[model samples]
Target: MAARLRRRLALVALVRVFKPGTPGVGRRLAAVPRLIAATLRGQYDGAARLATMAVAAIYLVSPFDFIGVAIFLIVGVLGDAALVTWLAGALMDETERFLEWERGSGRRPVA
Candidate 1:
């Protein structure tokens, strides 16, 4: 799973961030606000998932500061690791989905 996640995130960054054309990382970054708006407007069925991911993100970092890292060094590091792993995978996947939706969206692409 670790190797798979590593490959997935690396390839995504290579193709989406470095490669030109299409939305890529920049396009996905731009789409973030739109994605949120769409989710709020009842456009995306995965809105609950998005909220859960966000909450998990917040939960991961919040209490870790004062309780996890300060008292338990190993636990702090583990929390950090989980944060990196989860956020990296989530960002890569969500952006890809948003890009696909953009391509299939109602607005036709300009030649």
Candidate 2:
């Protein structure tokens, strides 16, 4: 029981060491959004991006391409992140406009 507890503790410690806010992980976390934005904006103008997207699309359309499925999983994560960012930006813009309108009306108490 002691040995199992120690092993589990060690595994937890190892996972914490590699957690997202750790020093070395910052670059990778930052890169994910950059990659997603680049892909969405068509900035990755080479064979690699094309190949990745092609495989992803194939996997999306068909259910049997194992390799394509893997590729799609990775790209889909990035795409989802990009979509979230895009939607958040739009939401912020709308919120700002609403706030501006409220301020201009001089009827609501400012918080």
Candidate 3:
């Protein structure tokens, strides 16, 4: 099970690293608004997950950070990339969880 989880993480990381031409990019982008709507309606099972996503979004937009711009520039642009990657992964994971919840609750949209 642990190995399976590790492999899943690696896969997600690789997908995020090579974004912009991936198969699920469009679907994932579409899901973001739906996720937010579901979240607003209190449809998801976990408030903690929603709050964490909110915090991540805020952090991404805020100019302040633990690492200054000068420091990031010195580090060859790793800090921003790492933060964006983490945010993307978190959003994708949260959206997927919400989708599962929708299906489980019999609220999934009919295609």
Candidate 4:
């Protein structure tokens, strides 16, 4: 059973490396949006949180002091998430402003 599981995992890794746009890539990429949306909505689930925890674990295992690595990981995750959220909000605001300006100019016909 363990051997079968290892083989399956190895096959998945190989496929992900050789077939960049496979369904697995799409699913993992899709998970990012779902993760962020869940975070924003305060509905984080085990899978999404596990993804974050994995990142934190990587940070912990890196060549750094354990306590400092953990603190850095916490801060990094919080800062990165906040930055992304803020950037998205800024992008939406900019897009809305551009649309408003376009409407005011009356250069384009409404569809």
The candidate that wins on lDDT is 1
lDDT of each: 0.61, 0.40, 0.58, 0.41
Model 4: weakest 10-residue lDDT segment is 1-10
Preferred candidate (TM-score higher): 1 or 2:
1
State the lDDT of candidate 4 residue by residue for 1-111, as single tens digits: 111111123223334434644334333443444445544665432344345445644654566535653679887657556544443333333223333333454534233
Please, what are the lDDT tens digits per residue for candidate 1 over residues 1-111? 111112245235434555455446665666777777777887655476578668877867686565877788898878777666666556656765655665566643232
Task: Write the residue-wise lDDT of candidate 3 on 1-111 in tens digits.
Answer: 111111134238446535664436556566677777776777644466668757867866676654465566745357667767766776666555555555566775434
TM-scores, all candidates, are 0.66, 0.33, 0.62, 0.35
Against the true structure, what is every candidate's RMSD?
6.7, 18.8, 5.8, 16.7
Q: Where does candidate 1 stray beyond 4 Å?
A: 1-23, 108-111
Q: Residue 55 CA error for candidate 1 (Å)?
A: 0.9
Ranking by TM-score: 1, 3, 4, 2
- For candidate 3, the 10 contiguous residues with the lowest summed lDDT are 1-10
Of the two candidates 1 and 4, the one with more favorable TM-score, higher being better, is 1
- Count clashing residue pairs per candidate: 0, 0, 0, 0
lDDT, model 1, position 96: 59
